[model samples]
Structure formats: structure tokens, C-alpha cells
Target: MEKNDLISDLLVKDDELAVDYYAFAHPAGFLDKTSVQEVATALRTFIDTKVVGNQPRRNVILVSHSLGGLVCRRAILDYLELGRSAGARIIGLLAMGAPHLGTDIARIASKFLPSHSVPDMQPWDELLQNLNRAWLQRVVNDGDPDLGLEQRGSVKCQVVFGLKDRVVPTASATAGAYLGELKAINKGHIELPKAESLHDVTYDVVKQFIRQCIEGTRTAPVRRAANVLADRARHLVLQDADSALEWTRYEEDVVTLGPLPAPEWLRCEVNSTRTGGLPSADFTICLALDGHFPDGVRIDYRFHFGRGLLTEPEYAAFGERLKNSELAPQDLDRVFGLKHLYLGVGEAPELRIHYEPHDRKYGAGFALLTYRIQPERLLGVGRTNTLHVCLWSIISRNHGWYSYRATRLVLEKLTLQLIAPFPALELGSSIWWCEPERNEDKIDNDRYSSRLEIEGPIPPGILVQWILDTESAGLSR
Candidate 1:
């Protein structure tokens, strides 16, 4: 394509974020002089040949300001149809001042323009009306359509509104959850660049969001590792005569920990002593969080697992989707720390956990793991609809702390299927457990205390057992 003065002028600062930027070559009345299809075709060709080819797929986040956003939307549709593999990799679409519903400026500009002007540029007229079709809106806002605005699309969107923008009203920029809403200080309609904070902040949020997507898709699987560790953990606890506890739930506050270096895995432990040796831990599933979680924020406990529990087939499906999804790194990395593990909810909150092994040399085993599930703190939709225990092994025994304090689980069930034995006595701490006091007067010191606790969502027909075993007799023996 030949170089045009109009395109050169439009692309004033492509390097705003030290990356490829573009300017269009269409002249002042170019759209007016040409047919909509011709204008769209020319614009698409220019973007593909010049703009998009430079960046890797999904790595490019198109931040279109005003009319530029409209241009990006059109270009994306053409690119997808042209076999660009932009289905998932086209990370995010940020519309600074796009008039998805048309603007009054189009009306004002039309009065001065000759009636023969191009259709789309006529401002809120038939041409513009046809562009904002339901199909186009859906395309621009792709992903898990049911997840509101934020969860569904390969191309994420964030609408930036300038409170002081005289050209476009704030209402026009308001979109649902899929695309986040950002505000700028007194920035003009066409002069968003003039507000350095707005530009910098927006660019950072978008860049980070994309980076996380990339990291999540690229990170390796941790299911195998989690399984290995979980098995070891269970056996370790069962061997301690004093340590016979059930895994109520183990939820981790990953937000503060940032997206973990690898995907996270989860397993369930059931008590079998009650149901004549029935199978426990049947609903166990693991996840490789890899890079999808953002730093500092980790995963939100409320809706974190609703869509998170993916089977192997579901896991494999993400690969194809990644081709069209946006990729980015972790953002907001300061809230790093350990939280707690809870079981059930409300009046009978039980913090289910084995005694944490702090000083193992003196003796460490399940006898050391003591804790009940706390119901009040459980943040989930319903008890049965969502499982609570999510054990994260980010904490290493080499760290000297034995276990990470913040890495725990929360089970929201009513009863757990136990395949192992459980402690016979009950502890006094409503939701807390304590070590048994050493007394020389006792005959059989092997006896310990535990209560039968259950959470939500047990699959039908599957017999779950609750086991209370002496740590010393089990793994230790």
C-alpha cells in the first residue's frame, strides 16, 4: 500500500507503550468517497499487512480511543474470517470512547457534510446503525457468554470513561462485567493521552490482565505433584495415634500469593470407619492454575471453583480456546500471605484439619493435625453446589514451617465419606483443636478425641466413609 499523509497524521504515537502502534491512511473524506465494504476492506488489509503482523497472536491488546475502537472492532471481524487464528489469542479490546450506540457528534457533523458522504461516517444514521448489530456486539465481547462481561471472551474488553470528556457521555462507555470500567481525571474526548495517569494506569491494567492469561495457558500441570503430596500427607497423619482428623476443606488465598508458579491440585479425604469400609475422597479433582490467577488477588473464594473444577477433557478443551484467548502476566502482586481452612458454614462451623506438624522430631503425624471447619467464614453459593477443600502445596517442608499457614481448605458439606478411622473424643474449641495434655495417670495414652463432621455435595450412590485411625498405628506402625 502507498504511504498516505492522513494515515501518518492519525498515528501520532504508536510507541506510547513502547510497542507497535498504527495510523490509518484514509483521507479526510475517504470513507465518504468509498463504499462501506471498500472502506472496511482497505482498513482490514492495512491492519493485517501493517499493524497486526508485527505482534504475536493474543499478545496484542487493541486500545482504541474514540473512533479508533470502532475501527479495531471492524478489523477484528475481518481478521478472524481471514484465517488469522485470532479466535482466542486476541487478548483484550479496550474502547476508550467508542460510540457503540452512536453519538450526537455524528448528527452535528452530518449537517455540514454533503448528503453524498459515506454511510458509516454519517453519524448515527443508517450506516452506523447497521454496524452495531447484535452479532458484532457479541463478537467484540466474546468468551464465556454466561459469565457476564468479564468471564466469557477470548477478547476481553474494558471501557475507559473520562468524567470530563465533553464529546462522549459516560453512559455510552458503560458495559457489563466482561469489560471493566475505568475512570480518568478531566480527560477530554480526544485528549486521553494528555492525562498521563489515565493512560499509564489503563495500559498497566490491560497489560497485566493479558500477561496473566498467557501465563495461565503456558504454565505446566501440577495435578500429578499434588496427588503425590496429598497421598503422603494422608498417610503421614493416619500413622500418628493421636492424629486422626478428616480433611474438611483446604482453601488457599492465592490472590495475595499471586498466580502460583504452577497449576494447583486438589484432593479429598473421607472417613470410612462409620460405613463398614466404604470409599472416601471420591470427588477429588486437581487443577493446574499455572498462570491464569493474578498476583495479590489470587482466586476469589466466592466464585473461584464454580467454573474451576475442570475434568481432563475440560482441561484439554482450554488448549483450543487458548489460540483465540488473550495472554498477559500477573498484576497487583502485594497481598502475599497464608490464610486458613474451613469446613461447612453457619451454626456448626467445623475447622477440619489434622494437627499441623510444627515439631516433628519430638513426634509428627496426623495426631499433630488438629482443627475444625469454621462455618461462618465459608464464602460460597451453597453447601452442596460447591466443594470447599482446596489444598495448595506451595508451602514446602524445607521452608522450616512444616506447612504454610495460609494454605488451607474449606469444605461446605454435611457429611464426608470416610475410608479411614477417626478420633473418638471431641475437643472443646468449637472450631479449634489442641494437643492432649500428658498425664502419667492414664492407662492407654493412644486414645484421642475427634468429632464426626460432614460438609456439602456428596454424589448419589457413592458410599463415603469417615475414618479415625491412630497416627502411630497407621503410617507410623
Candidate 2:
């Protein structure tokens, strides 16, 4: 499966939720783009609405991932500088795979993808070094006597990271975490925010933290300190600083509670399916349903690449790039990968864009196509919401692929259709829901050829392996 998607929806499954959660969306613009301090201002503005006299009426926890952790930390730091405690409302920050010290991925990605965001996350960048230094003193070290967190506004922080994370190193991700607040798992960076199920380690840790934060035990820190050494015990953890979470910038003309979507978004993956004779993206996704809106949904499906979304001029530029680069016609994905899915979607909610290859320990050459559908638009009449989409891409090959891991959501119905070039071999697939069928003789070599279909109730681990024999069928691999 893919780890690029956000898991904020999973938070809704908690029955004993202590605070109302919000998945903050960043502001849209080049000027207000992925800068750390700017996004922090927007974050502070948003927090203002939820608080009275600069302190929240209820307990708050900030859940952040990657660069978003940085944005949240900067917001808190800005408030501490101004003698206004944003942490009074924000009692706890749950940082998942955040880079407190800059990441090396940003250093390398900066070469092909030259964006200000890259430098912000580099380990040796000045801004990053300063942010960490200030944080260690004022936040972690509790340097200011007048700014007492324990007496007036107490804030707690916890960090969770994987030993195997390829994006942000474990050392950088957990630099500010204390022994009491730190958790180390074996999963990768992308898998840090997720759990195997509600009963797994991820959810268990979150539930315990929620209980502790809501309790507001004043003497908890004293107890933690009693069992301590020099660089040792403390009940609190530190927050994140870079990338996906930005300290959004707001120009004087438009300053409000809303954080706009940035000019360019980090790339995401689309299900490999063929649509409208394009190849049916030969892909299928299984998500759970509860009410009018999808209660818990896990979407990892693909549709064969069609054409739309991109502006005509933008499309032409890519076509020209393909010709001039002297790359094979099938290598158009490489050209799109160079651009980093520049959405440029200023203040608009809809995300319609191109494809890019994933980095940071992902499979090489597997170009990712990203899109977003509004919740109102995605939900349907009853519990089951089936929306047909056309994912436009320049690639032609349609290999067999599927994702088994579905978090938070339950899968009740399953309908899978696999279509490929002729002389295909359907190796092995074991799943049953309603019905199953096969046709070995279905063919048309001229247009686009070969096909397979399956319908079933998905079990825990169902594997399907097949071969289309593209070389013998005169189809591109």
C-alpha cells in the first residue's frame, strides 16, 4: 500500500475523544507558501478562535507529521516570544516522523526540485539550526523564569518515530523527545502515523496520551524528574519544524484564521487502474462506510491514465519536453516527475494535477498520480459511496497491482476487474464476495487488448499475480 496519504480521519474513530480535532489545511499562494514562520502565524490565528484570553477552555493536542510538526513548533515558539501561551490551549503535541533537525532528503531533492521548502529542512541550514537552538533553551530547557509553563500554561509533548524511517532520520525526528515521552517502533517513516488496527501499538499509545493530557496532573513532571539523570527523564516532549506542515505566510491584505493550500503540494500516489478504454486502470479499492459521510475510508486504488485536469499550455510544455529529452514515448512520467506536481491552486479546495515519481525510500520509477475529491462530492445516498473518476496520466503500461492494508475503514463489498493485453496468464487469485468469471478469448490487438474480472468479499490477505505477455503481444512493457 501507499503511506503518502494523511491519517487524520483515523482520529475520528476514538469514542472517548477529549478534544475536537482539526486537520489544518495550509493557505494557498506563492508569497504564503511553505515557509516555516509564515505558516506558524496562520496556525496561531486559527488557535485564537478556539481560545479566550490566549488560553483554551478545553485541553488540546496537536497531531503533526513531517514538515507540519515544524509549523506547529514555530507557532508555539512565536507565542512564547510574545508572552502569549498558545500551548495553554495546545496541551500536547503528538509528533509523528517530524524532523526537529533538518533531513538529508531535502538536501538531495533540492537539486532537481529547487523550492524554498527544501533548504528549510536541510540539517545544516541556518534557520533550522537557530530554530533547534531556541527550542532547546526556551521550550525544552525551560529557560525563562517569567514564562512559567507549570504555574499558568502547561504544555506536554510526545514523539513517535520508526527506526526504519527513510524520509526523516530517527535521531532528527526524536531529538527533542524525553525518555518518558518517546516511542520507537520498527516501521518506516511513512508507516509511523498508522497502526495495524485499533488494538495495535499506535492506537494504544494515543489513547494513553489522551487520558494523561486530559487529566492535567500538575505533579506529573516532579515525579518524572525524581527518576532522572542529566540528559534524562522528563514527562514532556518537543514539537516538529519543517515540510508538509508549514508555518504559513499571510500578507497584510488578507489575514484571517484560514491557512491556504501551498503553490506546490508534495506528490501522492494514485491507484493503477484503466478507465474509458484507456485500460480500466485495472485497479480496485476497498473502503468502509457508516453514515452520510464515509466514517472510516482507506483508499488505495488506481484507474488507467486518461487525459484532463492539466491546462492545455502546461500539457504542451510536457509534450515538448518529452520530444527534446529524446526519451522513449513511454518515459513521459519522467518528465512529469521533474515538475513535482505544481498544483498552483491558489485558495481553491479542488486538487487536479499531474504525476511525479516518489522519493525517500519508495520503489524507484513508480510514478505517482495525485488527486482530491471533496467529502460532499465523494459521499453518496447510503453507507456505500461509489464514485467513478478518470485519472489522466501520460503513461501506457498497466501492470497488475493492489493494496491489502486498509486502516480505520472496513471493506464489505469487493468488485475487481483486471484488463490487459492478449495472451494473458491469470496466475492466482483467491477471494469471494458475489461472483467470479473469466474469458480467455477476449481480444483486439489493434486498439487495446486482453482482460480479467473478479468479485468478492475481501479477506485479510488475498494475493493476485498475473502476466500479460506484453512483448509477445506487441504491447509496450
> Which has the greatest lDDT?
2
The TM-score, computed over Cα atoms with residue i paired to residue i, of candidate 1 is: 0.36
Candidate 2: minimum summed lDDT over ten consecutive residues — where? 250-259
User: Once superposed on the true structure, which residue ranges of model 1 sit more than 4 Å away at CA?
Assistant: 1-40, 51-58, 80-88, 115-152, 175-178, 195-477
Tens digits of per-residue lDDT for model 1, 1-477: 222222223334334434455556443342255444454567766655666565544255565666555566666555555544543245566677665555565566656665333335444556556555533444543422332232223455666666777766666555322345454534566555332432354445545544554454321112212322333233321122211223233222211111223233222221111111111222111122221211122111111121133444743444333333421111101111113333333444454433221211101100011223333333452333223333322321111101111111223322221111213111121122323222111123433332233332222111111122223223221
Error of 1 at 436 (Å): 32
Backbone clashes in model 1? 116
Off by over 4 Å in 2: 1-7, 27-33, 50-58, 85-88, 146-154, 178-180, 217-477
Q: What are the RMSDs of all candidates, in order?
A: 18.6, 27.2
Number of colliding residue pairs in each model: 116, 43
